[model samples]
Target: MKRLRSKYTKGEEVKFISHLDLLRVIQRALRRADIKVAFSQGFNPHPRISFGPALMVGATTEGDYMDVDVEEDISPHEFKERMNEVLPSGIKIVEVFEVDVRDSLSSRIKGADYLVEVFLKKEVEGLEEAVKRFMAKDTIEIEKETKKGKKLVDLKSYLEEFYLIDMNGERAKFYVKMKLGEGSPNPFHLLKAFNEYIGDAFDLEYYKIHRKNMFLE
Candidate 1:
């Protein structure tokens, strides 16, 4: 068996699908492409396919990763060609290569960068000042609901970088980098905290978020 790591894109068409649904789509595509993925050894065997991180619904991604163990020793180029032919329009395999079977893709991810564009109901002044104020604080807390209950999470620690990329009268775009995995906050949480800090100037729902890149260690 050979372990293959693939980098794919999640475009606007497939942004609304859940992570589980995306997995199903990929699995079906693999079967249709005639790729022999290795199955787990058990009564109810399942494909040995794994993904890096779960992307938020309604958000697009430029770079996402998946690792699959295939029974056949197919070349990376042939595998990519086969998979792309079967995958839907929105999801496309851009790169594929053989990987060491010892380490998984999710284990190597450390951080992710996001591009967020906010559409305001009305023009809000001092946007830059509000952003500065948010970053200047010692702690930026927001309520996060877990299985236990709602708890306040300090976003400042997970937030690595934040800055405005573009702004207009009723629209603003931002670049954000935050730590990923294990209790880390997503980009939406960071935006929620910022909106609260700025006295809820922008509507939380009126925004476009796209994951720009994932940083792996």
Candidate 2:
């Protein structure tokens, strides 16, 4: 069996697709592309495919990774070519290659980086002061709704990186990289918490949010 990782663009509208559906689409796409993917030996065999972490709906990515297992050996270049040929317009495979025999992508996925773009209809209220005060806090507590009830934790403590800048608002596009914990919320929601930290200074309706990139470690 051979395993490979590929990068694909989360095309505009298709970005709304749930991660589960996205996985199914790619599984079928591989079959249509004529690649023989290896299936697990079990009552209900399934392809060995996975994504870095789930993406929130309505977010696009330039660096989305997926691992695929194929039944036969095919050079990475050829695999990339074949997959690209079969993928839909919104989704295009950019790179492909054999992954390490022992190493896996999951082991490297430390967290994800996000970029959010918010436009100014009216000047954000107390924006500058809010940014300074929010970042200055050694820890920021956020209330998260859970199965049992709301759980409060220090979000700033968990944050690997975060920033609030204006876009042209271009780069003010709130760009942040955060550690992805098991069952953690999406970064977009984390932005909501950030908004609170800034005394609700950001205009949510005017914001055009997009997940620009994701990284491993």
Best by lDDT: 1
Model 1 ranges off by over 4 Å: none
For residues 1-217, write the lDDT of model 2, one tens digit per residue.
8789887788786877988888888987899889998887989998888788777777788787888888887888998888888877788888777877565777777777777776554346556566567767888777777788998867776577666665453224666777766556666566677676555655666555566666765
| Each prediction's whole-model lDDT (CA) | 0.89, 0.73
Clashes of each: 0, 5
Could you give candidate 1's per-residue lDDT for residues 1-90 as a string of tens digits?
999999899999999999999999999999999999999998999999998878989999988888999999799999999999999999
RMSD of 1: 1.3
Model 2 ranges with Cα > 4 A deviation: 120-122, 125-129, 145-150, 167-172
lDDT of 1: 0.89
| Alpha-carbon TM-score of each model against the true structure | 0.95, 0.86
